[model samples]
Target: MTIFGEIAQITLRALLGRRRTLLMLLLAAIPILVGLLVRANARPGPVDVGAFLDAIVIRVVLPLVALVFGTAALGSELEDGTAVHVLTKPIRRSTIVLAKITVAGTLTAALLVPSTIVAGMLIAGLLNTRPGSDPITATFAIGLGVLVGSYLYAAIFVALSIVTSRGLLVGLGYALIWEGILAGLLPGSQVFSVREYVRGIAETLEPSSIESIVGSSAVAYAAIALVTASVIASLRLAVYEVRGGE
Candidate 1:
């Protein structure tokens, strides 16, 4: 295999081998199962699928799952000294970071996107028959939002792991406080919020009457953040101090 592929493969295996993969899978199921239950209950009211996608799936679940996968992909390796083995290889440090983040982002999307789609579909079925809204558009928008959100967050968390041993705690704080509470409540802070960027992308696609905060500019911001994080992570890995497996 090529260098990127090799690193990606190892990262994927390491992530999947952990019990957290199963836990993430179960977490992904939450929206799907809830949608099914809500559908079975038989109600022709305003389902507000867009709201659910914003508040629950994208805001809460996507970040949580990305936190686990992104940090663990690199954090555990660095902590246990396995990362030193990869670092010793005659490979570009950027390539190593790229591979690991790629696998993490891909795996995160694979896990969360389908669940978002299925849940959207269920909610669409429940809400479509009512009136003025199109659930398919909402579902497509939410799916795209989840995709962008997952990858962006993965890149960021990967960089965070490189910078600190307490990356998980830091990531959780960013997710809960910075993105979750501050971003939503403070208009000025939305400029720095990842969730707002994700929601902006979704709103651009489907025009949510409720969560329309940012514009297409959100996409630009997200792209910039992803690239910046990836570059910083590569730089950190290049000169990273290794304790020889401690």
Candidate 2:
């Protein structure tokens, strides 16, 4: 437990450096800032604020931030050879992977959820009449969905980081091309999409307000995928050949 705590602490410090922390704050604040500006400036009329928020926050911002933090958690260490010392420690590799996952997931959620809730509230307020889902329900749904997405995405990216130096770029391609475009366009792709898992949860809570292609049943697959990725990551790191620093 102590070892895990140390790894988590180190991971947090590495991932949350001054510039990166500022970037995360700015990324999270995107939705809130945009929502406030819209609320203040846009003329009063019937608008689908929920859908707009969904597109911007869920589809775009959430994944981008997750990619950044997730890759940074371990990928940076691997690239810079700082992880060699940690790898040589008398600790289980799974512990290291778990710690990285925990920190990355927590950090991503912390950065994302508040902005989502605030943006949801602002959008809910803008609407003169409530929709199928109440503001509270919608806010909860978005927060929950983003939380789930952040954890799952972070786990996958952390694993990718161990396997490849270009994990961030690969994650970006997957997020933009695979999950973002394919999942929406190809029904078959929904089965393998993390976004669908997130949408499934949100839609289960507020089916009308949240747009989802797959039903709640798919959430199990998402969980399984997350676990599989973590396990694979641990195994990879356990036997990883760390070389001298560059």
Candidate 3:
């Protein structure tokens, strides 16, 4: 296998081999279970389902899962002193950081995207419905949003891991305190929250509705630009840190 492939394989094994993977699986299941309950008890409409997805899955679960996987991708290696061995290889530091973040993002998307889609479908009652409908389109829009959020969160957390040994705790604080509390309470803080960006993308993709609970098209465009910049900046920082060593 190629060096990138080898690094990705090792990262994947390390991530899945941990007991924490079970916690991640449980986190991924929350939306699905909530969907079932909503479908059974509330008999929710599309708007209700969309609101639930925006509030719970995209805003809360996506960042949390990404935090776990992203920090652990390289942070665990660094913490346990295993990363020194990898650093001694003849590979470019950029390549190592890229491989680790790629694996982290892929795994995050794998776990959360399907869960988001299944929950949206269940809550919107799209299982037996035909394609090309608004509900189906909306359900898919949420899935797409989750996919984008996964990568963005992974990139941010992976960079954090390179900079600090306490990446997980720091990521949790960012997720809960900054994104969850401040962004919701403060007027302008949503501009800095990854959750808002994800919600903007979903709202932009879904069909227009008066009851839309997420962001506007302007926010979506901003999200695209900001996410691109964040990913590039994060990779650059991670590469620099890896090259500099501890």
The lDDT of each candidate is 0.84, 0.84, 0.76
For residues 77-106, write the lDDT of model 2, one tens digit per residue.
998989888987799999999999999999
TM-score of each: 0.94, 0.94, 0.83
Give the per-residue lDDT digits (tens) of candidate 3, residues 210-240: 1333567535644565456356535554454
Give the alpha carbon lDDT tens digit for every residue of 111-162 in model 1. Answer: 8889999988887877444366677787888788889988899999999999
Model 2 ranges with Cα > 4 A deviation: 244-246
Per-prediction RMSD in angstroms? 1.8, 1.8, 4.2
For candidate 1, the per-residue lDDT at 44 reads: 51
Prediction 2 TM-score vs. true: 0.94
Pairs that collide in candidate 1 are none
Candidate 3 lands at a TM-score of: 0.83
Give me the displacement of residue 129 in model 1, in angstroms: 6.2
